[model samples]
Target chain A: MALLEIKNLHVGVEDEDIKILNGVDLTLDTGDLHAIMGPNGSGKSTLAAVLAGREEYEVLDGEILYDGEDLLELEPEERAEAGVFLAFQYPVELPGVSMTNFLKEAVNSVREARGQDELGSADFLQYMRERADMMGLNADLTKRSVNEGFSGGEKKRNEIFQLAMLEPKLAILDETDSGLDIDALKNVADGVNKLRSEDRGFLIITHYQRILDYIVPDHVHVMLDGKIVRTGDKDLALELEEHGYDWVREEAAAAA
Target chain B: MSTTALDTSVRPEDRFISAFEVNHGEALNGTNASISKQRTDAIERFAELGIPTNNLEAWKYTDISSVIDRPYTLPLAPERPSLDTDDIAPFLIDDLDAHRVVLINGRVDEVLSDIGDLPDGVVVSSLAQAGSTHPDVVEEHYGKYADFEDEALTALNTAFVQDGAFVYVPSGTVVEKPIFFLHLTATEQDLLLQPRHLFVAEDGAIARIVEAQHSLSDAQTFTNTVSESFVGEKANLEHYLIQDQGPSASQVHTRAAQQKDDSVYTTISATFTGEVVRNNVTIEADGSFCESNFYGLVVGKDDMHVDNHTFMGHVQPDCSSNELYKHVLNDESTGVFNGKVFVSRGSQRIDAYQQNDTLVLTKDAEIYTKPELEIYADDVVCSHGATTGQIDEESLFYLRSRGLSKRRARILMLQAFAQEVIDEIQLDSLEEHVAERVRTRFSSYFA
Candidate 1:
């Protein structure tokens, strides 16, 4: 069985009958970096959101199996503890809650969920400084509010920094490169690359092909209308980059 | 302490009957006639309005029945006791010279205080002395700015008014040092202390005052206080009321400021004690181009209840007011915030904003908040909002994920919530003092 498997997944927002992720199927084995490239409104972010167990989205018909455990049965925080991390496209700004405190809570909660002893304050601060340095984040930013007044690039880097701190088994990058400049994009991709291990998987969701050049995925999947229609190697991403998403639409139509 | 036994012959209409009827016909030997008349008028008002019950809209959440259950006789003028200045030394902000006006058991204690330097044309003395020396100033502004007719606490304060602080800054004169009114209620027996403060800042003048209500003993006590301030045109006043009494004490405090045109008034209330404490502040902009800022921080633990009610009225145009209050409730504590802003007719171009935010740490802790905005003028901007919620779980998880324990994460979150209000305080020393007190109050939970 795959390390991460979604069989006939269906999901929608609560209080709405309209489905967002309909009959979606995907499988990812350990050591695989899969890029889900699609146009806007193609359910790229919704898949990331559903897999992270966002409270607003309801999983109506799917079963998500993460390393032989039912992923859908956990709460959002629980899903986070089970090594499922989603880098939000638009990070929420929490004023007054400092970045240091936010990351400390997240790391210790994940540790406790995994039945590990929590780290001491001095050790946590040292660890944060090292991880933040890897992502080119300022140590002072950790003393300020979480994402409050932070530039867009800073927020994205903070997310990657969190990914490095949490060390999840599966990391879902949801539009992680959207608001970043070239340098910020390089820093984020570098952080992700460093975190890549033999036992970890990655789902890189994005709309553009520019980020792929840096993060170089093992497989590329074209998502259209809430379903993955095409699966190919890295060359497919370059091909799609040369010819826009319209070519994928044409191929999907031809297959139909 | 049975509820039924506490309910007696005192009818709702005659709650203050016995207390008002027993009058020390002869004025206390040393008190002046002006103070006597002011006390008499306050007693009459108290008899007329009586103590407020839950039926009153603003007092709905706070039940003062337990306070009124026993008939509290006004304490006689007892011999003043000496205080160890070291106990209060920590609260004194360093480097700033302050005139310390000490009041013990409703009377001035001149022995334990230091009367600091005063600028030219500024008078800092006890209220009883003001009544004799500056009767015109005392009779004109004393109790006139406060709404004694509607506030029972104001009336009660007037009924028992004995000694407090009287500060008057002349026109264009600036007093560099703050005038500190230290109300120390010390007693092993039940005591009722009523203190009054009257501050008048002349046009173009500036003054800062700090009124601290505290109890050195842990016995049961009741402290009722009323402080009225009048700010003239172009004057600037910074006033702070800090309550640090023991947990067994109860207090009812009313502080009001009337501002003239082109004047600025700022009031900060820090409440960290008392078993049941209610603080009400009213600010009326009676002139144009007046600006007022009201800020309060209440930290409660165990079974304490802290209720704060504030009113800001813009009776003239070209005025602005901003109010922000924050409360941190832990254990089974309760908090109530009632803030109202009224822009009366003809008060065009008024700007008013009021916000109340509370953090409930435990399931049993509760907060009831009501913020209202009444604007009669069409060309005005007035908005009010109140919110009560637990700390954000995502924010909490985000903090815990950084490797800090859940307890420390919670303390940081609560401190952050409080810092939003604390950061707005302009006085650095007072802000640090309040922040330290908040940390100390929550230190047990974290430990």
Candidate 2:
């Protein structure tokens, strides 16, 4: 069975008729890395938000299957406990919560839900120190409030650090490379590459192809007008980068 | 023709005035001439200024008529209700290494207290005892800082200032552990308790004090308390006031502090549960290079009402004051914060900032926050801000997306909102206790 399968998903903002995702269908199996590349308003982030069960977006019509069960029926936290994770495009700043405490709660909550023993303080600290080093997250940042007074690049790196700590089975990265310098981008990609395993799936949503050069994806999908217009191997990302999204639009229009 | 005479009903203030006139001689039996004169003058002041109504600017958001209009047995000469340590075990913060001073119905109960051996030349005793044992100190500092010329509640408290905790640290002496004042109100009938405390830290002395009030019974209680603190030159004083009473208990607390040159004074007030709690704290920067900080947190639920009114008077040059008060109101609870900062003329290089933030959880919850800054010095830097908002949905979602349950996520958000103020608490044990109390309160409400 596929790790995640979204069938005929139609979503919109709650209490509004303006649709964001119109009959979008996608599937990802275990060990598969799928990259969704699109323009700004192509609903790539909306699809990611819908998959993560964001409350603002209403699932108008569709069924999301995770491991052969209805995924949309679960709350965001429940989905997270079921090994689904969403690295937000814009990480919210928690003014008084330290990163260590937040990560501890998240890790323990997931572990408790999975019937695993909670990590002790020493073990958790050790784990956090290692992951933070790998992601190049400053030690001082971990002790401060979560994402508070953090630079854009630091926020993105912190998200990646949280991803490593949570260790989800199917991770969704929503424009994680949006505000990153070249070194920071490489660091994030390297962190993602290290976490890639046969039993874990990834959905990388991006607008630029520069991130793809470091963390290669198995398949690249072009999204247009709230739907996937074309799907190909890694070369499709390069083709799109060279030809721009205009050709994808023309192709989608011609096909329609 | 029917006579249209004016409707003149006896107000709550008139009732209080009558009660004072009837009980004045008995209340001042053992007091000195100075204290007796102060008491008489204060009651006269109270008569001139009655119980404040909502019509007044300071009491605009909080209406004390409903609480004070009813008849209450005044604890003028309160009989100490015998309370064992077991009875007050719940009120004491665990692992708090401090000298414990117990007060029952406003009078210190030495039998049940545990004020351990203190350093030499440090006096920690009841106000009445200090009046006799250290007459000169009491006369010099008592009733000095807390001026009741305009405040009716403070005046009323002064009129009935029978007994409370009084600490005097001599020059260059430091009270190693905090002096914890545990105020317990255990009565079988409706009671009104007025407890007045005086704390004086001499030159270069340091002292940390903690005061927690609790009502042991279900009877309606109204507590009017006034405390005056004098921080001497280069002296440091940190005070914490915790009010965690029952549903039937209400309190009107006034704290005034005068800071001397190169001294630092910090006051943190946390109100968790109460019927109607109003706290008025004023700090006067009387000397140069003085620093004052005021941090307050209120987490109220279930019809609880907590109002925090603070004043920072920057009277000297090269002084700074920072004030922050946060409130979380749930269910039908309400909160108010009115902070005023006054910078006198020629008080150059003054840096004063005040901020009040509130989070209203339910639709019926409300908060009124105002920050008043009156700066007469053009060269000083002063800024004030007040904000009332709901819980941040984005932060909640972010927490839940990390796998926390909705209930836990909401509680965490509230805790984080409150921790910003709790983090300012310098004492480790007090901070832990407050953090635990806030977490429990938030969990129960969210649950």
Candidate 3:
């Protein structure tokens, strides 16, 4: 069985019943890095949001199985506790709540849900300092409010720092490299590479091929109009980068 | 009893209009002629304006009918109660030298107060005594700063103005210690007391004053007070008003502070009592480069009602104003906040900001907040925002999921929300005291 499997997922917002994700099917096994590249409004981010259990979108139909468990049945925080993490494209800022406090709360929450002992304050601080340094984040950033007054690059690096701290089994990077510079992009990619394990998997969503050069994926899928039109090896990213998406659209129309 | 006749003609016995006229007529013969004239003019204005109803924009949410239903008993030849310094020792602040002025049943208890240490050129005395000795100073600025035309409570306080404190800081002088004014009301019968305060800080002078209102008995009483502060050029004044009366009491207080060139005025108000309470604070920047800071925190539980109205006017150029008011309502309590800032046409380079935020813990609790800014100056920056909502559910859940019980999570979030406002208080001891009281009140909710 696949480590993460989605069979005909259909989702949309509550107020407007217009579907954003119409029957999207994908599968990824452990230790695999898969990139889903698509144009704007092609439901790329919707898939990542649905996998992370964002309440704004309603799952009208379908099944999302994570390690033989129904992922759709869990709450967002519960899904987070179940080793599923989504690096938001736009991170929410919480004023008056320090970054260290937020990470400690998130980490201890997952640990408590899994019937594991919580880390002490000293140990948690030491762990956060190490992960923060690895992500090229200053220790002072952890003392300030979470994501408040942070530059775009610093915000992205902070996301990866949280990813390293939580150590989710299945991570979804939703346009994580959109606003990052070359150096910040390398730092984030290095943080993701450090977290790669045999029991872990990643679903990288992006609109550009520049990030692919830093963190190469094993498989690349082209998503068009809420469905994966084609799937190929890492060379497909290079092909799309060189030939653009119009050729894939014509081929997908012919195949359909 | 004719409806049309009653509406057309202004009668001297009308409940709303007559209350002021009667009190003013009696106060003309009092010891202070300047205060007396000011009261007379204020009463005439009160008759024209009448008591504000719900239709009035400023008094929309808070209705004063319950307290104004019957005539308040004005104390007559009230005996001075015997009280010692030991009686008020618990309320004193350590490490600061303070002059204590105690008022018992709205009358000054001169025998019990301590006026020992005094800086040169500084004068502190009873308002009645000061009226006789310093008539020129009294005539110059007494009651001239308060607007009795529109405010009925100010008119009422002027109409029945009895005994209160008077403090005068000379030019270029700084009072190293805070002056404490304790207003204690103890009555067997339902009474209405109007306590007046006139404070003047001359040019480049600095002083700190704290006023506390408390009651000895749980009797039903109505206390209407007006405190007017005048700050001279380049002077600094810090004023604190703390209202913690009994649960059976009701109070309406109007405080106004006038600022001159380059002067700074700061006011912090904390209200934690009264079955019904309403406070109106107004600050006018009448000189260039003046600054004002207004901060308030209110906690209401059960069926208590607390209303706050604040107005800051920037009439001169290069002035700044900042205001923040926070409320925590629980049970069936209700809170109202109306904050307004006005920048005149020629008042360029003025900066003003106001914010009112409230948190309702229960469905029955209600809060109405309206924050507005009226700016005519093109070069000025003014903004006002008001928000009323419950605590953030995600933050609460995040806390609860981390081994903290549901109750602990709620307490932590509520404390954190209130801590923002508490942190703005510059006095560390007072801030800690207020925080402790807030925590104690919050703990009762869980019980």
Candidate 4:
């Protein structure tokens, strides 16, 4: 089994039966970095939302296997404890919870989930200081309320900083490149690149190929109309970038 | 008991009438001769105003009619219940050494109090002693800020006022240690206590007044308290009221303050548990360039209802006032926050900001919040906002997606909400104490 496997997964809004993901099949083995590129309403975010066990989205059919267990059965927090990380598209701003405190609780929660002792204040502070420095997040930003008043780039970079701290086995970056300049994009990619390992995998979802210029993906999947139409190597992104998603859309339409 | 001005038809069975008769017969004559006139007028005014009802605009959400019906004996001149230092040591903060004035059932407990080294010219005496010893000073500042004519609670408190903590910091003196004003209500019988405290900080004086409540009895203890704080020119005073009363205790606390030129007055009220609690906090900025801040946090559960009423009056130009009150209600608890910022007509360049936010955890919990602003000055800057909603789902999901359980996430969110108010506390140790309190309160909500 792969690190995260989604086999013919179908999803939609739980309350309103608006289909989002229709029979989407994807798999990411250990050490794989896959990018899902698509236009708007391509079910790219739906896949991320469903994998993270968001309550609003229902898994209509099929299965999500994480570490040989049914991923849909776990709660959002449980999936996170089981090393599934989702960098939100619009990072939430918690006005009172300091970034530092949030990170401390998150780290301790994961440790407790794994049957490990929680970190002491001083020890956790030292550990966090090191990771924060690695991600180039300043001390002042870490001390502020969680993502409150953060600039667009700072919110993205903070997500990467958290990714470094949690060190999850599988990370889903949902629209991480939506709002970022080239410099910020490079900084975020650099942070993610540093955390790449044989035991880790990433599913980067985006609409543009600009971010792919920084963090090269091992596989690129083109999605349209609630399904992945094609999967190819990294060059496939450039092919679509040069020729545009027009060809991919026409090809899927003809096949359907 | 010839109080013809009082309307007996409202709550015909109210025991407050008898309670007032007992206080008028025993406690009134013993107060300062100068204060006796104020007492007589306030008692008459109490009879006229009577017990506040839910109909009044100021008290639209709180009803005191049921509370007054209970049979309660005002402990104005009752026999002292024997208590020792061990009985109150737990109520005192374990962190500090300070001047302590312990008021037990509306009377001073001199033996249990520990008055550590106070600065020279600083008077940390009981209000009863101060009324007799410094009668002129006590009379000059005592009820000067309180509005007994309009406030029934103030009138009721003033009519039966006997003794409370009194601290006077003279000009050019700095009281470095926090004065611990412990109002301990403990009795073997049903007792309604009326405690009156007068705090005066002279020109260039600085002090912090800490009012902590300790309820040792579950026998329907009701405490009615009135505190008047006066800050002189260029003086600084930080007042904090922390209520950790018994589960069934009912409390009515009214605090009024007048700030002088270039003075600073900041008050924080943190309420934990009470059957019914009504707090009226008023800050009138009388001089230019004075800064006033009011921050409060209320945590109630299990039929508890806490009502906080604050009036920030900007009477002078170039002064700034800020108020933030947050409430976390659970388990059918109810809370009300009515804050008003009134800017006088000619008070130009006055800045006032008020915010009230309530977080209701359970479906049965409810909150009534009203933030009001009446500005007459053309050049004044005033803003009032109120938000009553459940915890943020996005923030909760964010916290939970970071590995925190739903309960843990909710608790963190609530703590962060309270930390905003707790951070405004100027004192470091007090901030920790409040944070600890907020944490403890949320644990039960999660449980």
Candidate 5:
């Protein structure tokens, strides 16, 4: 059985028929790391947004199934509680909310849903400190407001830091390597890699092949013109990086 | 002061005039000759001023014309009303090791008060008792800092002032614990409570004062409270006022202070819930090297009106002042903030900063803010700013994305915005107590 299965997914901007995702079909199995590579505006990020249930995206047709249950029936928060995480391309900044407070609430919210007790301050602090250490973040960032005045790399790192603390079963990385330098990308990839397990699945979306060198995925899917034109092993990513996106575009156009 | 009698065409004004005439003789029984003269002068001035309306620039946002529309018998008597202290116990700071002064309907309640041992020369008593005991001190400071002639509410308080807490700290003495004033209103019918409080910190003295206002009944209440603080040379004073207007409450508060050379004063006013509430605070820096810090937060919903007016006068050179006022409005709640900083001539190197920030939770909620700065000194740095906005959509989405319900996310963000100001409270227990109150207040919004 698949961890996540998307059949005939057709999505577009709300209140308009301008489609972004046209009958896209995909599936992710347990213990599989899938990478979606595409050029700008290739509907890569739109897939991530639709999967996260953003209000601006209207899912006109299709069904999203997670672990054999209809995922589209859940709210964004419910999706999050059901172990779907989208590592935002650009993490939002909350001016007055401290990182520790946000992480505590997030962890407690998920924990309570799973019939687990809320973490006490002492235990929570220890839990957070251990996770934060994996991302090379200090307890200091936990004290500061969440990503407020943080550098570009620091913002991405904070997202991965949240990813580490949440430990979601199916994580979605939407351009998580967009603005990161080599060191920061390695930091984020290392943080995500540390959380990978046999029971977990990940969907890594990127426009560049730079991040694939670190957290190599088992399956690589090429998206072009609102559709996945090709699918193969990790070698397809290297092939696309070497050959560029012309062949994928030609193939998608010819098929259309 | 204008002595011309105001046309008592306004029904509430007429009632007030009749009440003043009826209570004049008995109310002046214990006051000294000087205070008696001040009282008579204040009442006469109030008769001329009547109730201030938005026509006056200072009262533009808040119109007290409707505040006195209903007939309310004034709580002018000195008798303590009966109340269940247990029911009102939640308003008190549980472990606060401070001197407690309780007032029931504008009259001091000595039975419920706890005035622990104090250092010599540090006297805490009722305003009337203080006047009787320290005539010169009372004569020198009472009704002086308060601009009763111009403010009808202050004048009204001065006219029929009976009993409020009074604290006097002699030179070089430091009161270890805060002097807490727990003012409770316990009238079921429509009533008005006017309390007059005075604090005098002598040269090099230090004092901490905390005031909380609560009500016992669900009846309509109008409270007009006036408090004046006189900080002598190099003295320090800290004051905090929290209004928990219980069940159809309306309140008007005037807090004024005078700071001498090198003296410092910090004051905070927070309005948690009320039907109609307004606070006016004025600080006069009379000598060089003085410092003043002012902070305020007002939160309300459902046809509630909360207004705050603050003025900082830099009458001395080399002084610094900072002020921050924030309002969070939800569900048809309206808020108003008017702040002014005046740096007079020859007050060089005066640094003043004023900021007003408002957050509107719903589309129906509204907020109006005015930050005014008048700098006549060439070497002064004076700045004022005002910001009005709704909660950031991105921030809300971020919180909601992490498994928090929309309601929980909103409450958390609102708490964060309010806690920033509460964090400025220097007192430890007081800070925690205020944070808890703030959290509970936000909780009631969802409730």
Candidate 6:
């Protein structure tokens, strides 16, 4: 069975006529790394948001199955507990919530859901420090309020740091390379690469192919107007990066 | 005792006046001529001012008619109820090392309190004892800062002032540990209590005082408390008021502080549980270079109502005063914050800042905030702002997406919102205790 399966999924904003996802169909098997490349407003981030169970977006039609279970039936936190993680495009600042505290709660909650013992404070802190170091996240950031007063690069890096802390079965990275410098981008990609495992699946959604250089995907899918228009190997990203998204739009239009 | 609904026949003010007349002799009996005169004047002032009405600007938001209209046992000197340490163990902050002073129904319970060894020339005693022990200090500072003539509740509290905690630190004396005043109301009958406290920190002296109010009964209790604090030249004083009484209790608390040259006065008032609570805090920077900071946090749940009225008078030049108050109201609870920063003429180079922030958790919850600044000085920096809103949806989703349950996410968001004010608490034990109290109190609603 696939790790994640979305068939003919249509999503719209709650209490509005605007539709964000017309029909998004994708499948991710265990150990599969899929990169979703799309132009602005192509609904790449919206798909990620829907997968994470953001309440503002409603799945108007179709289904999302995670491990053969109805994914739409789960709450956001429940989806997280079920080994799904979404690296937010814009990390919200939680003033007065220490980064370590947040990570501890997230880590222990997932562990509890998995029928595992809670991590001891000492061990957890040590592991957090190691992961933070790997992501080049300042030790001080772990002590301060979560993402409060953090730089753009720091916020993106912190997302990867959290993804490392809460190791999930299915990881979704939504534009994590948006505001990162080359070095920070490489650092984030390295962190992601380290977390890649045989039993885990990754869905990297990005507008650029910069991060793909560090962590190559098994397959690259071109998303246009909320649908996967084309599928190819890692070379597809380099071609799209060189030829720009205009050709893909033309191809999708011609096919339609 | 069971309290009947509000009775509008006899005016509430007249009932208080009659109660004072009946207890005047007993209440004022051991007082010196000067103290007795002050009591008499205060009661007369109370009669003139009467129970504050909605027409009064200060009392506009808080309508205490229901609280005052109900018949309560207005005992000037109520008999202390039997209570052991275990009775108050639940109210006590864990691992706190401090000189404890316990007041039950406005009277000090020496048995439940432990004011261990203190440095020489430091007076930490009941007001009745302090009256005879440090008569000069009491005479000098008492009723001087809290203007009973203007505030009717202050006048009412002064008229029937009973036993309360009094602390006086001599010149250059530093009280190593904090002095904790635990005011408990454990009464069999509906009670009305008036407790008065006076704290004086002389020149170069430093002291920290924490006053907490808790109740042990289910009966309706109304507490009218007045506290006057004096911070002398180069002295430092930190005062904290923690109001977490029973659900049936209501309070009208008045705290006034006078700061002298180069002195620092910081006060934090946090209210967690009460039916109706009104806190009036006033600070007078009487000398140059004085620093005054007053912060407050109110976590109102259910149908509770909390109003905080604060005033900072920059009477001297080169003084700085900062005010910050935050409220988190859930359910049908309502919160009000009216903060005023006044820079008097000739008070040049004054820096006054005031901010009030509120988080209305439920759609039914309400917050009314007004930050007023009256600056007459040309060379001063005065900034005042007030913001009231619901929790940020983005922040909430961010926490929930990280594996926190919706309830837990809401708890974290509210805690984060209230932490700015809680972080101002200097005492580690008290800060932890208050934070846990807020968390536990918030968790129920979220759950």
Model 5 chain B is weakest, by summed lDDT over 10 consecutive residues, at B1-10
Measured against the true structure, the TM-scores of the candidates, in listed sequence, are 0.80, 0.95, 0.79, 0.96, 0.92, 0.95
Against the unseen true structure, what C-alpha lDDT does each candidate score?
Answer: 0.82, 0.90, 0.81, 0.87, 0.86, 0.89
Residue by residue across B1-447, what tens digits does model 4's lDDT show? Answer: 211222334463234555456556555566587566677687778778877788899989988667755656555564566888889878877676678888788778888888888888899999989988898788689889988989877887777677787889999899999998888787777767778889999999999988889788888877888999999999999999899887878888889999999999999999999888999999999999999999999987888989999999999999999899999888999999999889999999998888998988889999998888888999988888888889999889989999999999999999998889999887777788889878987887777
lDDT digits (tens) for residues A109-173 of candidate 4: 99888888999999999999999899888868988999999999999999998999888999999
For candidate 4 chain B, the 10 contiguous residues with the lowest summed lDDT are B1-10
Off by over 4 Å in 4: B1-26
Task: Give fnat of each prediction, in order.
Answer: 0.25, 0.84, 0.04, 0.94, 0.63, 0.88
Candidate 3 Cα RMSD after full superposition onto the native fold (Å): 6.0
Per residue, candidate 6 scores C-alpha lDDT tens digits across B1-447 of 112222346888888777677667775555544456687888899999888878988888889877877878766554768899999998888878999999898888989999999999999999888888778898899889999888888888877776688999999999989999999999888888788899999999999999999999999989889899999999999999999896899999999999999999999999989999999999999999999999999998889999999999999999998899999998999999999889988999998888999888889999988878888889999998888888888887888888998888888888888899999999999999999998888778765
Among residues 3 or more apart in sequence or in different chains, the pairs in candidate 6 whose N, CA or C atoms overlap within 3 Å are: none
Error of 2 at B110 (Å): 1.2
The deviation in Å at residue B292 for candidate 1 is 0.7
> lDDT value for candidate 1?
0.82
lDDT of 5: 0.86
Over B63-157, each residue of candidate 1 has an lDDT whose tens digit, in order, gives 87677555444564545666677765655666545788777766677776788678887988888888888888887788778877878778767
Ten-residue region with minimum lDDT total, candidate 2 chain B: B1-10
Model 5 ranges off by over 4 Å? A239-247, A254-256, B1-10, B83-88, B378-380
Candidate 2 residue lDDT tens string, B1-447: 111111126777777777777677775555655567788889899989988999999999999878887667776665767779899999988889999999998899989889999999999989988888898998898889999998999998888677899999999998999999999989887888888899999999999999998889999989999999999999999999999888999989999999999999999999988899999999999999999999999997989999999999999999999999999999999999999999999999999988989999999999988888888998998988888888888888899999998888888888999999999988898899999999878878766
Q: What local lDDT score does residue B63 receive in model 6, on the 0 to 100 scale?
A: 90
- The DockQ leader among the candidates is 4
lDDT of 3 at A210: 90
Q: Tens digits of per-residue lDDT for model 2 on A1-256?
A: 9998989888889998788887888899989999999999999999988888889998889889998899988999999999999999999999888788889989998999889999999999999999888777788899998999999988988888899889899999999999899988998999899889999999999999999999999989998888888999999999999999999899889988
Positional deviation of B42 in candidate 4, in angstroms? 1.6
Clashing pairs in 2: none
In candidate 3 chain B, where is summed lDDT lowest over 10 consecutive residues?
A: B1-10
Give me the displacement of residue A188 in model 5, in angstroms. Answer: 1.5
